[model samples]
Target: MAPKHQPLRTALIGLSSTAATSWASRAHLPNLLTEQGRSKFTITALQNSSVEAAQAAIKHYNLPPDTKAYGTPEDLANDPDIDVVICNTRVDKHFETVLPSIRAGKDVFIEWPIAQDLAHADELVEAARKSGSRVGIGLQRRWLPPVLKLKELIQGGSLGKVLTADVSFYNGEEDPTVLPEKLFYFTEKRYGGNPIVILGGHSLDYIFSVLGNLVPESISSQMQIRRPEVKLVDPATGKTIKTVTRDTPDILHFTARLQPSQYVVPGASFHYVFRSGQPFPGTPTANFTITLESGQIQLTAGSPPGLEFAGPGQEAKIKVWRRGSKEAEDVEWKWENVNDEIGPIAAAMQVPLYAFADGKEKGDGWVDIEDAREIARLIDGFYKKWEQDGGL
Candidate 1:
């Protein structure tokens, strides 16, 4: 590891005490405060919907008294002290929230599904390129220990001649009965909060990172809105708020055949299915199965109703069964062993952050904005296929 020099000054947008339990607070903030992370980065500014909210978050997190609080993203972007801008806002607001920072030529890290749609994503990419600013997306699953190990095992020829891969993700969020008032925005596909982009996209990124990027030869998809009318519940009172009609598809299934590529025999393929709103009762939230000529590898991660970030008490498990071995071998991974200061999810997230910082310092250590745009295009393909097939 390079010796720490000046810490990267960072500003977090859409982070506040009001949403204290958000992914940003749980994963990003905690990781940044760790001893190891603090050595590399410093939280110099915070932006929320209002100055009062930002100030409250500063006090709640007990940040340095000198940390600046801004009501608008423009103010934070204009602050020369900030070296990187981290945006954790909703997908719909991503383009606007990150635009000012890009225009100011500042490196930015935006959470996954970079924008509401491909058009918005293209605009951001163009702006970043023109300004020569580095952009990082929150596709941190590739950095997870199990994922890294899987990639290493495949690349090292442990899973010789990969044949096929299957991934299934089931979360009960799409259920109309469990909808929350605050999350009603997710019912609209235009907001880019559907399961296909959130869960399926992450799973696809994980698969591609391990098997190497494959060109899609063909694609078939099906989408349906099982629960059109959803009842919203108030978290505080545990009472029903109101019912709203939802048009977004709650269930999505897609399969694609890849051209003969690396990491596998001539015709390796991929298939994924994501279902939301349906109750899983007592089943794992996510599972991955990869088959190769020599053996098979399986992974189980997160719990029921799983969000992208692995929740507290949830750990990932991986098992490998080779043709010659009598019994499957369990793979163990501890993030503490890699970096004691940060949690597993945070450690994964730190990969992109470190890469972004390194690119700023050393000139080339981050995922390209073009790669992020490609993922966005892949997502666009899914929606297009659904429409062409006459969505259920």
Candidate 2:
């Protein structure tokens, strides 16, 4: 474990009672409470929509008795002891929740899909830059052991020259006719909660991470919403609550051509196909295939949104096939033993925190807001293309 002079004081925004069962609680809090993480980070504050909620979160999570609880984001941001502000809110709340922290010169860690649109992302980047604040975005899949190994193999020429790559993700929520009450906002485009922005954004980030410096020369995309209206269903009882019209597209298909490919050296032609949708019958959650001149590499996970939420003990399933091989070979890579106590999501969440702390001490290790801006641009490109082709 890396030595730390003192634990970094941390504050959490949008951490409420509801978070106990949400992704933030499942993936982040447990990791932070681990022995290794406790050595690096100390939870000092909690912020919620109301003081009651914040206080409730503090009690629910068994935080330090002295941990401050604040109703407003500004109050938490201005706290002198907060060294890191972690925002795990809904997509639409990110901009407002984190802006004060950035302005106050506190390093921040925000979950993926930094903002609802490119413009908001650009603004956040600018603010962080102006304040000289270290910003970390939760594109944590890149830190997964399998993903790291894949990058090493590609860079080391294990796959020879790259030929083509294809990625398909199914979120398993395609039945727009039924959504949980918490997910009702996803049906509205204005909130930027659609699969295209959330799931597609992460998919693009992971793709770029594996390709390493490959820039797209051309992009073509199509987005469509197969179900115009969706019903709200009670998650526990599986009964419909109500029906509402949905404007956001549930399906996204895109193709990109990368320049300077391995086959052509400084100028090789590389192609990629990206597809995402709601959950469908007989469809795997996610699959990624990369074909090279000499061999092929493939990765699949049960839950498609991100590897971070992969099922327990099944973070990623990887396979490799060579030209002369009779069948594909399974690749075994285990996560660090220290992370074994937590679920896959919690294990992945620990990565960004480590990077954030390392970057604060050593000056380089985490993905910043600039990376978020790039992803936002990529997502915006799809929207623009869809507009040009007329709405589906």
Candidate 3:
């Protein structure tokens, strides 16, 4: 059921070391390069704002000599060989970089926040719509097997009624001053706003992915600045420097309502918690508890890949039990990676990508997009309520 067109052509437009390792290197490149993905797309080129950086990455990855390396976004956009552009770049530069590709009728996969706010995301959504190009946001967690299973169970009537559900996360990294400078992505808000917009956006987006559609009735959030500032030494000279004015919220808490009781996954409520600067001692861990009208399910997700950036000991576990049943059973699934599972988890989570590439999964490609946009709208709704309530 592959696409009628020949294999999709792809290129990487930002080759920073961070982008190389964080995503393109770990998941996108490796997964797409597989024999299975080879049938769908080929990684044709690498680009960067700097020629030296792009060339170094090309040589380091040992790409073919014909592989093009660019010193600017325009160069890559003009390269007719690339049909799909994967952009992993600075947050501020996302809208600018991806717009060119959209104009050229090349589909694009861009990092999250699509832009700093809703207007940009909508604009990008509209441009792609007009150009007949596909746009993918890198919120890969929605594709996880466990999540998909949960969604299916609800949709299939196995859960009967998902009465209430909760999702929570904890890891130690509360102090922004101590984090690496490159992590400004999380620390800066005006560029993309705070964790509520960034981190919470991803988690909430996935929750919407599971629930189908949501109408956020109310939202309340609080942000705290624990350290205020931090010092870092020059990597080469060992000179110390202090940074000031960390405005983003390291901690975010909120709640919203699901739309239409009819669409409610039967017995569902969501609770999410995230803690930074307080790393759990063992492996990184994420867990959720669910209560169904007939059965109960508990899920714990291990911190994989970039989560390691949050620090060690990551694992995922899902346990289920029938009401009044004597015993509980654990559902076992394969781990995607040994060194760093974030890649594998992300790969597994990309269910829609495979569905789209295969051409037979059902619905237009935007089935997931519809779910995501509704979630985005809800989150925006929550933010508006927060503004009304003096949350800022």
lDDT values, one for every candidate: 0.75, 0.76, 0.61
Which parts of model 1 have CA positions greater than 4 angstroms off? Answer: 1-5, 172-176, 277-283, 302-314, 324-326, 337-341, 360-366
Tens digit of per-residue lDDT, candidate 3, span 216-329? 444444445555565543445645555655655555565544553553653245666665554465644465676777887776656622232322334456677887889988
Candidate 1 structure quality by residue, lDDT tens digits, 182-295: 887777788987666776677777677777665665676677777788887897887888988876777777777655556777667778778774435555577788888899
Instruction: Kindly report which residue pairs in candidate 2 clash with one another.
Output: 172-279, 173-279, 174-278, 174-279, 177-231, 261-268
Model 2 TM-score, all chains together: 0.91
Q: Model 2, 88-119: lDDT tens per residue?
A: 88888899999999999988999888887778
Query: By TM-score, is 1 or 3 better?
Result: 1
**Cα deviation in Å at residue 137, candidate 3?**
1.7
For each candidate in turn, the TM-score is: 0.89, 0.91, 0.81
Off by over 4 Å in 3: 1-4, 17-21, 155-159, 171-177, 193-195, 220-227, 230-240, 260-268, 279-284, 302-313, 335-346, 349-371, 381-392
Could you tell which candidate, 2 or 3, scores higher by TM-score?
2
Worst lDDT run of 10 residues, candidate 2, spans 264-273
**Alpha-carbon deviation at 190 in model 3, angstroms:** 1.9
Q: Sorted on TM-score, highest at the top, how do the candidates line up?
A: 2, 1, 3
How much is the lDDT of residue 139 in candidate 2? 78
For model 3, where is the 10-residue window of minimal lDDT? Answer: 304-313
